[model samples]
Target: MQTILIIEDEKDLAELVAFNLEREGFRVMTAHDGLTGLDQASRIKPDLVILDLMLPGLLGTEVCKTMKRNEKTAAIPVLMLTAKGEEIDKVVGFEVGAEDYVVKPFSTRELILRVRALLRRAATPPSPGSVVKVGPLTLDVERHSVAIDGAEVSFTSTEFKLLHILVQRQGRLQSREVLLRDVWGYAFVEDSRTVDTHITRLRGKMGAAGELIRTVRGFGYKIEL
Candidate 1:
């Protein structure tokens, strides 16, 4: 059984999630506060983590950073849950090494699908063809690193994949729905703003290379010369 650590503070919601996950044949571990969550994460080394942004004692972003930085827990995938309009922290979460994001009031079905998908991707071997480059940015899909002008710019897996898709199709616009299906590996069910949040962080990290990624009004993003 693949163990999943759910770091959420809400008692009712946490238990509900645990019940559903256990029913789905997953081994569930719950942590009600951030400090405990971090401690459990290091010791348990779960296959994945469902992290809530608003946690007492440490907050989700910090947890992600701490886990991803530590050798013991660095490979564990994290999916962040955030309230709408907290796009800023969502970006921060991704920057800190989260693999995916789900907005608050999200369907349990969609959340579970995302969790399973992330774990699947984590288990899958990297394809040799996954790497991409555009302008000054080089995305090492295998290593999950982005470098600008030969300088390695740190990026989480999701950010690297998102940019890879954009750079692979430079000079063409992609709708938010398409990006979700492509980089996120999910269909049209997710909130489109998830793309925007990731784009903001991806651009911020890319710096001048970010100029290559342009937003189309009322549509989505594109990588252009």
Candidate 2:
């Protein structure tokens, strides 16, 4: 069973979420503060983390940043739960390494669906023995690793998948909607800005090779050789 850690300060809400997730057959763990959540995540290394945006002691963003910086727990996906639904807020959450986000006053059904989706994506194994080369970037699809100019670089699963799709398609301009569907496994995304955010992050991590991922301005993005 996949273990999920819920880091929420609101005890009642956290228990409610834990109850539902446990019913879904997942092993659930809860933390009422960001610091505790961070520590628990490091110790337990759950498959996924349900992080509340606002927490006492440490903010959710800080906790996520720290987790991503740590080698032990960095690969675990994070799904941010927040009351703030602004575009910028979601952008910031993604920037901090959240794989997905759910706004406040969300329905239990939607929350469960999002959690399942994230886990599904995480469980997907990369196709073996396939490698794609774009400029100096080498993507070994089998190993789920990327290297730029022979130097290995770390990427979130979301970032890795996004890069894989773009490079696989090569030179094709993929609209945000298409990327959202293909890369994020979302049929309909509320805010396609999520694509842009991941693209930006992908580019940043690619360093000088990032220039190969060109912005198509009014459309979306494309990988140019």
Task: Compose the digit string of candidate 2's lDDT tens values, residues 1-225.
Answer: 999999999999999999999999999999999999999999999999999999999999999999999999988989999998887888788887899988898989888887887888888877667878888999998888999999999887788889999998898999998988777666555658788778878888888899999998888999997
Superposed on all Cα atoms, the candidates' RMSDs to the truth, in angstroms, are: 2.2, 2.5
lDDT of candidate 1 over 163-196, digit per residue (tens)? 8778778898999999988776676544788888
Local distance difference test, each candidate: 0.84, 0.89
Q: What is the number of backbone collisions in each predicted candidate, taken in the order shown?
A: 0, 0
Off by over 4 Å in 1: 82-85, 129-132
Show pairs that collide, candidate 2.
Answer: none
When summed lDDT is taken over every stretch of 10 residues in candidate 2, the lowest stretch is 182-191
After superposition, candidate 2 runs with Cα above 4 Å error: 149-152, 215-219
Candidate 1 least-lDDT 10 residues: 82-91
True lDDT of residue 218, candidate 1: 91
